[model samples]
Target: MNKALPMSGVRDSTYIPENILSVPPNLSMEAAMKETEEVIFGAIVSVLAKTKVECSEIGILIVNCTLFDPIPSLTSNEGIV
Candidate 1:
């Protein structure tokens, strides 16, 4: 399934978390959380950089993830925004 991603039109530049690329995958909660943080923060940083928007000036933000429900809700993360 991992090797089929590029053939399925996923661009070469797209970020695939390390665990997902593993032979059997490491789907443990810890790995999921790391993947979540990497994707979310990476995207936030990219958009902020491109738009020149200050994080503090933003009024609303939303994040949706269906893979797993984390112990501390993602919205409750202190340093994200």
Candidate 2:
């Protein structure tokens, strides 16, 4: 029985990251976190690079992630260098 849909009407796309998002035995939490850190830091750097604000100029850093809601939050995971 051929039961493969045409993948139609899928609005959101969370399963697109080929490097970060992968199944077990192929991807590890550490690697995933590292990739995530790179992405986030890249974004921040991109924005900061565009502006005249320096890293020291930044006062408050706001990080919002609702996955691991407990001690040592997402923001605690240091960004890329």
The top-ranked prediction according to lDDT is 1
TM-score of each: 0.65, 0.56
Point to the candidate with the largest TM-score.
1
Q: Which stretches of model 2 miss by more than 4 angstroms?
A: 1-15, 20-27, 66-71, 78-81
Residue pairs that clash (backbone atoms under 3 angstroms), model 2? none
Tens-digit lDDT track for model 1 on 1-81?
Answer: 788986888887875779978989898877887788888888899999999999999988888888657658777755443
- lDDT of candidate 2 at residue 14, scale 0 to 100: 41
Candidate 1 clash figure, as a count: 0
lDDT agreement with native, every candidate? 0.80, 0.59
Candidate 1: which pairs clash? Answer: none
In terms of lDDT, the poorest run of 10 residues in model 1 is 72-81
Instruction: Give each prediction's root-mean-square deviation over alpha carbons.
Output: 3.7, 5.1
